[model samples]
Target: MEGLELTAFQIISAVGTARSCYIEAIQEAKKGNYEAAEQLIKDGDEAFVEGHDAHSGLLQKEAAGEGEHIGLLILHAEDQLMSAEGFKTIALEFIDVYKRFDAEKKEA
Candidate 1:
């Protein structure tokens, strides 16, 4: 794998890691480990940025008229990237909900 193929794999790997981190973050929040959950969110964001950067490179190439044929691999990578982004949003909301629940419990 070279060039576009290699870049697609990079995006897949980075976003895959981000997706896992976001899921794990939600689990941590469920267990009342807010700090760990927050750290995982940070980690996820870092991984997501790496993937986004790789994807952006492809976009820039296309804009510059250097576009290659988009293949199933690239499509899969984009799918994973979108999934990871969605997970990050869900994780943040879950963390907030968990924190609010914890606070309410404390008050009660």
Candidate 2:
């Protein structure tokens, strides 16, 4: 973990954690814990930013004609980043649905 390997792993770990947080947030919302769910979403956003920043470095290098050495690890890292992004959207939607359910229950 000294160069591309290091950056790639960092991206993978950060985004992976973000993805978990997003999923957990949805679970929390389902449990009617809106506060905790919101906090998890915030945490996930922070982790996502870190991963995106790391990936940006690689993009910058490529833009400068010094693209990443191109390896399976890096590709996997990119995949994780995309997955995390998708999870964020899904989590938000799930949370909203949960909130609506809670509201309806209260009204009932």
Model 2 lDDT per residue over 56-85, tens place: 999999899988589999999999999999
Q: What is the C-alpha lDDT of each candidate?
A: 0.98, 0.96
How accurate locally is residue 45 in candidate 2, as Cα lDDT from 0 to 100?
Answer: 99
Candidate 2 stretches greater than 4 Å from native: none
* Model 1 regions lying over 4 Å from their true place: none
Which of the numbered candidates is closest to the native, going by highest TM-score? 1
lDDT of 1 by residue, 1-108 (tens): 799999999999999999999999999999999999999999999999999999999999999999999999999999999999999999999999999999999999
Backbone clash numbers for all candidates listed: 0, 0
